[model samples]
Target chain A: MTYRTGTEAFIQGVRTLIPLTPGVIPFGLVTGVMAIEMGMSPGMSMGMTVLFYSGSAQLVALQLLQNGAVPVAVVVTALIINLRFIMYSASLAPYLHHLPRRWTWPVSYMLSDQSYALCAVKFSSGELGRFAPHFYAGTAGAMWLTWQLSVLAGVYLGASIPQTWSLSFAVPLSFLALLVPNIRGAASLGAAVVGGLIAVFAVTLPYNLGLVTASVGGVIAGLLIESIRKKALSNASTNDVEREAQ
Target chain B: MSDLSLWGMFLAVGIGTFVMRLSFVEIYGRWRIPTLLSRALVYVPPSVLASLVLPAVVYPHGQGAFVFDNPQIPAAIVAAWIAWKTRSTVLTLALGMAVLWGVKVIAS
Candidate 1:
């Protein structure tokens, strides 16, 4: 629970992130391949990769562009997909707010779902103490390096990778791995079920709006279930007290 | 889209995303997060991830149509089970890809 120094905590963070890199590598490779297949030059593809630093959003934008969608639509949809970062930013703010701008700015820019997931619980538990930011930086730095290098490899190896490999499926598979761990309680379970079903039923929506809708629906479902469970618990306690009075 | 236009779009998205990422961190002490919004934030990862995973699996091509015989559904189910049991990302991905390739071969 304690570390000798920030360097030790940072190394620990990097070590923990190593296991998740397997899930990340294929997704990054697929993104790189898809961008090239869509006729983007290697320089342009890397430019998008470095700029976006988001695999899913970048992939979605590339798909939209390949379909000849308007430039405005591509930009909007990508931004919408990146909306979850705002939630991550808010969640992490309390833990990281005290750091100076030099530390906070780059750390914010490097935030990703993987790093946030790793750090959120650690930060909340107050286990890392003063070295928490260093640990976070370690995870984010490793993830950034892993992603950029894998995508670069994919770009160079593009077209030669056979379609029969079905690498795109790896994207969902990795998400499943991440999703299973996040379902820690009934509330989170409700959120996942509602979100997934809505997405399944709303796949026909334009501009990939179904994703946004499904996410909102799922969060609301979770909140509703959580409040209901809380009320039931309170009522049961009150009834117990009344019986004791009798 | 032309090269210039494509770059412009990327820049727009990149800047927008950066702002969102910095939104709360930049103003953290200035404004407190409301209790309700903070509570809702806990569900964001599960809901958003499930939203992405389900659609991608059910509609393998990102097309709206759903098919009962899709290999991805079963592959995903198996992978989910493995992930739950093992909690190993490497193992889950490796087995999931293996299952998908096996199913495709058998179906053909």
Candidate 2:
């Protein structure tokens, strides 16, 4: 499928990002506040905004740091939490592999949730070409700049904002926003529920290993349920075919 | 721990994260991921998210007690409802902050 026009595609990509910004801006703000509370300077926070560019991992790292967890532990937790991005990046490789090395690094830096989603859709529609890279680059690049600016602004405001406000809630709220749309399948829902239950039971684990267990348990349960459901459906279908033959 | 060696640790985590992000694309560029690995990756987001949010909202302090003494629990419930109802991240956040602020005031 051919994209209509280069300019139109870029415009459309930017438009796609508009709806996502509302969720992203508040997350950026929360990250900024958490950074300050965790004893990070604005510069360090800005660095995080530019380098990591992940809301979930950054929030986890902030909490860990605030608790005085060892740096190694903080690093490890952040790594594990963000391990999903590797999948996202790998999935997009076919779309992005054509770009020059100079552009690749920057594109990789801008590969957040919104960018990945938008780029994945665009790439699948056979839109990889000269300006396609720029379309994604512009859209994601715009998001990255806006994210850092929001965080920087929040860091400044964080000093004045009272501790009672609890800007940290913004983090989960952002995730909640994303999670709602993705909960379309029963398997995914079951996984989430079972995962939540396991997490509650294992809340006392140090450095949040409980998170890993909950995640693993939920996935296993969901896979099991899905397998059973698929088997039942296939058996039913087979029975119908046999009845027709008879 | 060591006087918040801000820059040093920042550099370490930043580089580590960047390297990790780049690693998958670099290694798997030529090969497709196996089916089992694909299935496993599917559960990472929700499970990790649930794990992150559950402990914080339910038993935030790492203690074994499961009481709703903290305002985070009620606030999170209210926030989740608003998020589900409106599907508006901005609204969810605004309402959540308001709920948290109200709960904090009452509790304090």
Candidate 3:
């Protein structure tokens, strides 16, 4: 548990994320394969996998491209879809504050759901020290390497796969897999219903703007419902306390 | 999409995503984010994920564009249930893809 060397922390980080790679490889391959099916050049797809390093946003952009969306819409939708990274950044900021720009920026480039979730817990537990950044970088770098290789294989294999199998269907299927685990709260349900409704009705809009609109609407609905539900629960508790006091 | 436009989209997304990921850590590493923004950020996952997943499941094409009675709808519902029940990404992908291919073959 005492990680003295950066290499030790790095190894520890890589080990921590090993369990999660099973999930990452499939999703990464799917994104790569989908990019090819959706009309992306192999180079662009690979570049995207490298530059963006975000499976969800890359998939969203490819989907938008397939619909002949304008660049603005494609980029905007992808960024919005990736907005969670901001929160991850905020949470990890304190842990990274000690590092200088040269160290922090490169490490920041490696920030991801796995790295953030894993390192955040490590830092919060008051366990890691100066080596936290190296640990995070190690995890991120490992994930990045695995991700790039998977996507390359996927793009190449996706080209050889026959059209009759309809492999492109995996795109939505992967998304369904992502969505199902997240659908727990009233907020999520409300967001899905509202967003789905809007998406269905707004499909005809130019630039694939409907997707962005639905996403924004869904976020609003979820937040609104969540706040209201929380207020109601708090009020109910207060009322019970008042009755007891009386 | 033109090469220029495609590359432009890539640059925009790549830069935007990086900026977002780096922002709090590099730019505002010392700043304390407001409680409200953090709370709202929690809802982003569900909302954006639903927005992305639903249309693909419901339409299976660019909104109202369908050929040969979309099989994805039923497949998605089954996959969704499995996703909720198991919460394993691999399982969900397997079941979802199987159902989709299964529906397509049976319908044909």
Candidate 4:
């Protein structure tokens, strides 16, 4: 409600993401556990965290890399998985386009699913001006810190976790937590079912191309179904109007 | 997939993803995103997460085909339901992990 400094905006941003902290912690731990379990060198695995900073893409790359996929495929999958950020950035661009290059670079680097979600709503609320970038930086920084620390803890605890525990299942469980709430309608449900089925069916494709195929197929299905539903709803309303007129 | 190649994947993906993020931040309002692309982006999270989720829970890595053989499948089903109902990530994790461990003990 009041004009805020960059530091204040940053603090405010971190505050907004506090409730989501528990959700983020497990995913980071799962990523760290997977990196160690995959037999990656500790430094290399940590390097992946620092370099990629994305749990989904990191997990995807880890699985494919262990599967002996090519470098190009692995990189492409990571990039493809992160394509949503481009859209997020586009939406955020209007609020932050005026920022200096020095500020914009770091802000872009820290973009993630959680930060984008939190900031997108905030930015669109018209509360931000030049200080908006600071708020985003705050959310991203909090997430970055939590993720790295959790990964480190997981890496340190990698040996003692015990194999029988089936801890790796947490990765998918985390993803399920992320996905379940988003299934608001048939389009999303169609997207999930079709995309998941296609991923399995096309598993034999070389270089992890099946994953890419599934991503594209699922998005297309969701979008198509969404449009169809919209059309159906409009048509139904039109019919209702005609009946009322008679 | 070699050690050296792992580094390559890291560097390549790191740079590629960074550039993707920068594409919009740097361009900002100058370049417009197409309507189709905007619409498609909304579905990306569900699609990407679903693709990842199904494989991890069902096929896993070593398992052959997805049957009731893997403990993760049932645990994930319960987790999915918990997530749907409570919509709490912590509960889903705690309960899901508990279910998974319980199954492991009993199945053995």
lDDT, residue A85, candidate 1: 90
* Model 1: docking quality category: medium
Residue A226 lDDT (model 2): 59
Model 3 misplaced regions, further than 4 Å: A235-246, B66-68
Q: Can you tell me the DockQ of model 1?
A: 0.57
Ranking by TM-score: 3, 4, 2, 1
Clashing pairs in 3: none
lDDT of 4 at A77: 77
Per residue, candidate 2 scores C-alpha lDDT tens digits across A1-246 of: 334576766666676677777777877787888888776678778877676777777887776676556677677767776776777777777667766778777777677777877777777676555567667876787778778887887898788877656666666666666666555466667777888889888867776567667878887866666566666777465553222111
Quick one: best lDDT, which candidate? 1
Which candidate order results from sorting by lDDT in descending order? 1, 4, 3, 2
Identify the leading candidate in terms of TM-score. Answer: 3
What would the per-residue lDDT of candidate 1 be over residues A144-179, giving only the tens digit for each residue? 999999999889888787878987787678678778
- Clashing residue pairs found in predicted model 1: none
Compose the digit string of candidate 4's lDDT tens values, residues A119-166: 887688876666778888989888888888988877777766777677
Clashing pairs in 4: none
Off by over 4 Å in 1: A1-20, A60-81, A117-132, A235-246
TM-score of each: 0.82, 0.86, 0.92, 0.91
Which portion of correct inter-chain contacts appears in model 4? 0.76
